[model samples]
Target: MAQEKEIHFTGYEKQISNWTDLIPAERFTLLVLQTLTEVSKDPRGTYITNDRLSNIIGLSPTRISSTITKLKKKGYITVQRVGATGRYIKTRDYNHATLYTYH
Candidate 1:
């Protein structure tokens, strides 16, 4: 069985309101919103590949990728930090890691 992780949203009120107002038409954006909310809590910063997010949210990786791209285009998030190149090697096959901050 996959161990479930409980996500507590602490710093996500104004942004929630902002996002809701800015992109009410994008329905599936909530999943991406909540997922980013969960990861944004890491003080050391965080990064999520589509595969990891797909596993956590029970969606296909393609969906996660598209949502991420859309979120970036919408300007709701900004890359705050990034890891070294090849950081995801021998892991999820991603080339690097990026930490995003919500607006």
Candidate 2:
């Protein structure tokens, strides 16, 4: 078995602690948050759409939509649509890149 290696979180601990305080008690919030943190490699932000999020997380689009809406309303993130399409997942519809900045 490989030895356990120490992992560094940099200065994200404080922010994450605060996030727990920010997000209200709800189901799926933690799951969505973990996924967002994984995607956001940098502190600046990352581009991800609900469609892509659904696929990567194996959740239905409707579930993704509700989680996103809650996150937005809670001021956990700011999303900007970068495409003129109605969807952004791998579909036969228009494609888009959604910018997400975690707060």
Q: How well is each residue in 1-90 modelled by candidate 1, as lDDT tens digits?
A: 999864534343333444443444233444444455455565433466667767866768787666655655665444443556211111
User: Which lDDT tens digits does candidate 2 get at residues 10-29?
Assistant: 32333344445444332344
Q: To one decimal, what is the Cα RMSD in angstroms of model 1 from the true structure?
A: 11.6
How far is each candidate from the true structure, as Cα RMSD in Å? 11.6, 10.4
Pairs in clash, predicted candidate 2: none
Which consecutive 10 residues in model 1 have the weakest lDDT in total? 86-95
Deviating ranges (above 4 Å) for candidate 2: 1-44, 86-103
Report the alpha-carbon TM-score of model 1 versus the true structure.
0.44
TM-scores, one per candidate: 0.44, 0.44
